[model samples]
Target: MKIEVITLNAADTLQAQEFGADRVELVSAMNEGGLTPSYGTLKNVLQSVTIPVQVMVRPHSFGFVYDEKDWNTIKEDISIIQELGGNRIVFGAVTKDGEIDEQLLEKVIHHAPNIDISFHRAFDQVKSQTNAYKVLTKYKDNVKRILTSGGKDRADQAMDELRSLVQLSHELDGPSILVGSGVSPDNLATLHEHIGASEYHIGSGVRVNKDFNQLLDKSKINQARDILK
Candidate 1:
């Protein structure tokens, strides 16, 4: 199994790599559900971490619906990431009616042709995950994966939905599904056993005191790593 840790800064990035994270999702403003990190921070993290770094390209945090300026900002961020040698990018967009914004997604995918794109948790906001999965399948070649909690607040509460999504992904041979939101070491093994998902994304779960403001807890990360083993 692969563990992707969300890091808010350079220090967190280094700690995540040292504590055995397979990959790092670089972002800022966790309070706002993560915005794009500063260029300086992105450069520092890219230089400091040897492990794969997936930069979050979100322009704002209120919702997934983006405007023209937001899309422009996202494109700029993607260009910055590409120039900084970051290969993986995480982002998503949806319509007001709760569906994938195909037009915007195509623009995003076109802008970052050299990078692997992971549709972030915005998948959970869609009206129907089943329908969302079908929509994402159309862009399977450009979208590498989808990070979701099965359209629920917590993945554990929606295991059946997650399992179904996993099965669907396998059947289509499309994008991989990365389970996140409320995943912790305590239930990591259970989720793995039940959902059979190989990729897990953690943000606050591995933090000190489980607080995003604090540094990542090495012990917590080790515990999760041990369980994965």
Candidate 2:
């Protein structure tokens, strides 16, 4: 199994790497549900580790629905990150009516043609997950993965839906889904068994005791890694 860690800064990236995480989902203001990291933060994180970094392109935490200017800013951010050698881009977009905004998504995905992309949990906002999967499946080639909590607070609570999504996605050649939200060592095995997922994402559970301003906790990372093993 592969483990991915959600990180808010360069320090977290370094720590995640040392902890045996395969990738780091880079973001800022994680306390507010994450936003795009500053250019300097992106640059610093790129220099800090060899593990893949998936930067969040969210402008704020309140909602996934975005306006014209917000869309433009997202495109701009993608270009800047690509120029600075960013590994991957993580983001989400929804309409005011709670549907996937395919029109805007096509543009943003086009802007970052060379970078790997993952649709964030905004997938949860779609009113109907079955239809939502179809909408997202349309971009399977452009998107590398989808980060979701199974439309609930944590993986365990939504395992049935997650498993079904995983099954349905594979049936349609849709983007791979990386279970997230409340994933941790304690429930990793159960989740893996339920979803048959090779990849997973974690944030709060791992960072619960972390000091983002300093280096990551190597010991805690080892513990998490050992559990995954």
Candidate 3:
């Protein structure tokens, strides 16, 4: 399994890399659930850490539903990331009725043919994960990962659904289930035993006092790394 840490700046990426993070998701405006980091920050972070950095491509925190202007902005950000030698991104879009926006997803994949996109937590808003999983697997080549909370507020609290999703992925050679939210070192073993996912995304879990605004706690990160191993 891989441990993906959420990082706010170049300094955080360095800390994450030194502390056994297999990967890091770079973003800004974390208080609003993450938005795109500035170009300078992205460039500095990519240079600061050797671990794979997955940049968040979200244009806004208002919702997953997007318009033409939003689409253009997302495409623009992707171009910049690719130019900076970044070939990994985290993004997702949904329809008004909460279905995966296949149109937008397709456009992004085409826009960044060389990039591997991890469909972000916007997937949690879908009406049915089973149906959404089916939609995602269609573009499994580009949508290489799904960062979800098992369609709930917390992945640990949605074991039954997560287990089923994990099984479904195995059956279809589907994207890796990058489980996120409510994941802490205290409960990682239990979540792994129950859900058996291959990747874990952590935010506010390995931070000092479990606070997102606080610096990442080295002890907590090492503890989680040990457990994953």
Query: Could you tell me the lDDT of residue 182 within candidate 2?
Result: 77
lDDT (Cα, tens digit) per residue for candidate 3, span 1-229? 8999999999999999998899999999989999999999989987777789999999999999999999999999999998887889999999999899999998998888778889999999999999999999999989999999998899987988999998999999999899999899999999998999989999999999988788989999898888878
lDDT tens readout by residue for model 1, 67-163: 9999899888899888888878898999999999999999988887667888999999999998999999999887878999998899999898999
Per-candidate TM equals: 0.97, 0.92, 0.98
**lDDT for model 2, on a 0 to 1 scale?**
0.82
Which scores higher on TM-score, 2 or 3? 3
TM-score of 2: 0.92
Root-mean-square deviation of every model: 1.1, 2.0, 0.9
Q: Give me the candidate number with maximum TM-score.
A: 3
Q: For candidate 1, what is the TM-score?
A: 0.97
Candidate 2 lDDT by residue in tens digits, 36-72: 9999999999988998999999877779988888888
Pairs that clash in candidate 1:
none
Give the RMSD in angstroms, all C-alphas superposed, for model 1. Answer: 1.1
Least accurate stretch of 10 residues (summed lDDT) in model 1?
Answer: 108-117
lDDT per model, in order? 0.90, 0.82, 0.92
User: Where's the lowest-lDDT run of ten residues in candidate 3?
Assistant: 42-51
